[model samples]
Target chain A: MIYLRLFWEFFKTGLFAVGGGMATLPFLYDISDRTGWFTHSQLADMVAVSESTPGPIGVNMATYVGFLTGGQAGGMAAGVLGAAVATIGLVTPSIIVILMISAFLQRFRDNRYVNGAFYGLRPASTGMILAAGVLVVKAAFLPDGLSAFDWRLPVLAAVLLALTNLVKPTKKLHPIVFIFASAAVGILLELSQ
Target chain B: MKELLSLFSTFAKVGVMTFGGGYAMLPILQREVVENKGWATEEELADYFAIGQCTPGVIAVNTATFIGRKQSGIAGGIAATLGIVFPSLVIISLLAGVITQFSELTWVKNAFAGIRVCVCVLIFNAVWKLGQKSVVDRWTAGIFAIVAAGAILTKISPVAFVLFAAVCGIVLQTLLKKGGVGQ
Candidate 1:
């Protein structure tokens, strides 16, 4: 039953979570809230592990969830199915549309409305992407079980934002550098206390 | 072939180094695949990105498959896929041990916190820039707003959202076609 539930949940997550793996946060959170499949902390750990690992963070997480719920096979099942569902979910519709339109692509290829529609899609996708970031931020910093949301992280986030935009010099800085530098600074601060 | 091996290796390097997710992988992928190997042109890479966006897997994986298929045919596609997945497996395995062991380390914990926040910022920036290309008119802007609202209100599955976007594009295009504006 657990395995079936895992498969279904992941299948659903894969079916809908778009923009990328992080976009699945709300679904994962919902799953956690509804089922005791894993704790909120586990979800966070999954994010860390997923981010630190490879392939896709969301896929990595599905595998992690499967593994935690069942074991090796469970993990593999969840991972593969989650990936499959998500991939299929993401692709299936587009594939149908492309196939349907392939014959007429040339006819409407230069159509303004077609072009305009794509133009619209870009920002809409961007919005989804932005929403994904916010949801993840909420999950990452505050989490569900928190006694209180961490004020420092938000303040830190604002600092990072100002530093990125206003500082100008830091705007083009490699993300990894910011990642490591911030980490180092965070550690140093932790150690100082 | 050795060429296939090289393709595998380069994408593997990309797969290994990328920490966050799709957006994080973009710069490195562009640097290595587009800039370094010259295997794919910028336009081709952009096309791959669109296809990747429409595909059913990680954009990086879908991209590898597309590029590999383009470069070396079926075998090339397999090689590229292998290359991309390799780093992820190794990195995750190595990290599993290190993270498990160091899970409680203050420095490690803090560092993760720091990286997580940075990932958020990077995601925002990427979306912001990408939005510049996407929201070109009121109609598109309306699409953007509608999709954004749906995403926030429901946190709908990405698949549904993408599908919704695709339908919206198709319908708009069809209507425009009916109006004979393109002629």
Candidate 2:
């Protein structure tokens, strides 16, 4: 039953969580609210882990959620199976869609209706991504766990943001470098406090 | 068979090395599929990404499928898609046992706090670049503003937003066609 439920939920996620990985967040938030499979704080942690890890964040999240839910029912084997099922469920729609597109893309590529719809979708996706970015900014700065806003956090974010942009944009540093440096800063801040 | 195996291995490598999800994988994808393997041309890869973004599901999976199908057939697509996700399954499953407790630790929490901030910056960069590309004309700008506001301020389902945008585009394009206006 859990496997069936996991597959069903993630199939829907795969079908509709359009635009990319972050677009899936709203659905995952709703899942948390409705199913109680994971808490919002856990969702935040999932985001952090999914972003840090290799692979699509959406896939990582679905697998994590499945593993947790399955582990609650059984043990490690169930957890691993749940992870596999959930990942497959999440990618199923992509496989289907891609196959359909490839089949008809030659004939449909110049279709005006297709073009028009995508014309709209392009900006809409951009908006969704922007909203996603804003949400992350809000979470990063105004975390539910933190009762008080430390002004220094925002200053730190701004300094890092500027550094990412201004520090020789031509020969840009890898994002991993920034991630590690920021993590070190975070640990240092915690230590200082 | 050999080509399919290589396709699988190449994408598996990409899945392991690339972080930050689909957008971050773009360069690697271009490198492996377009430049290295000659499976797709640069323009073809760009087209794949465009369609991938608009279509349902993960961009990485969709792109892999596109290239895979181009290379062989349905089997190739399946191979590539599986390859892309194989690393995630193995990695996430391995991490699942300890991640919960590990995340709760103070230093881990601190580290996450920092990582989240960096993620925000990365998202901002993605949005800025996407906005420049997508929000070009007046209608698209309007669509962007409304969708952005709706997503942020309301509980409207994202699926609904996407459907509404598609409908709006059709209507707008139809009206423009009737009025003899160019998009």
* TM-score (C-alpha, index-matched) for candidate 1: 0.65
Per-model interface RMSD values are: 5.3, 4.2
lDDT of 2 by residue, B18-74 (tens): 666676565456456665788976445544655666688888888888888878799
Stretches off by above 4 angstroms in model 1 are: A1-48, A51-55, A58-117, A144-147, A191-193, B1-7, B23-55, B67-76, B95-99, B174-183
Q: DockQ for candidate 2, please give it.
A: 0.47
Q: How many backbone clashes does candidate 1 have?
A: 8
Q: For model 2, how does the per-residue alpha-carbon lDDT over A1-193 read when each residue is reduced to its tens digit?
A: 8899889888989999887787788988888898898899888989878865778888889889988888788999999898888888998998999998898875686888866776777778778667766766776788764666777677777887788777676226655566678778888887213
| Residue A51 Cα positional deviation in candidate 1, in Å, after optimal superposition | 4.4
lDDT of 1: 0.62
Cα lDDT tens digits, model 1, B1-183, are 998998889878777656667656655665577667888754444434554555444566666766776677667766776676665544443454354455566666666666667667666665665666666667767877887788788845555666677668778767766789756
What are the per-model DockQ values?
A: 0.30, 0.47
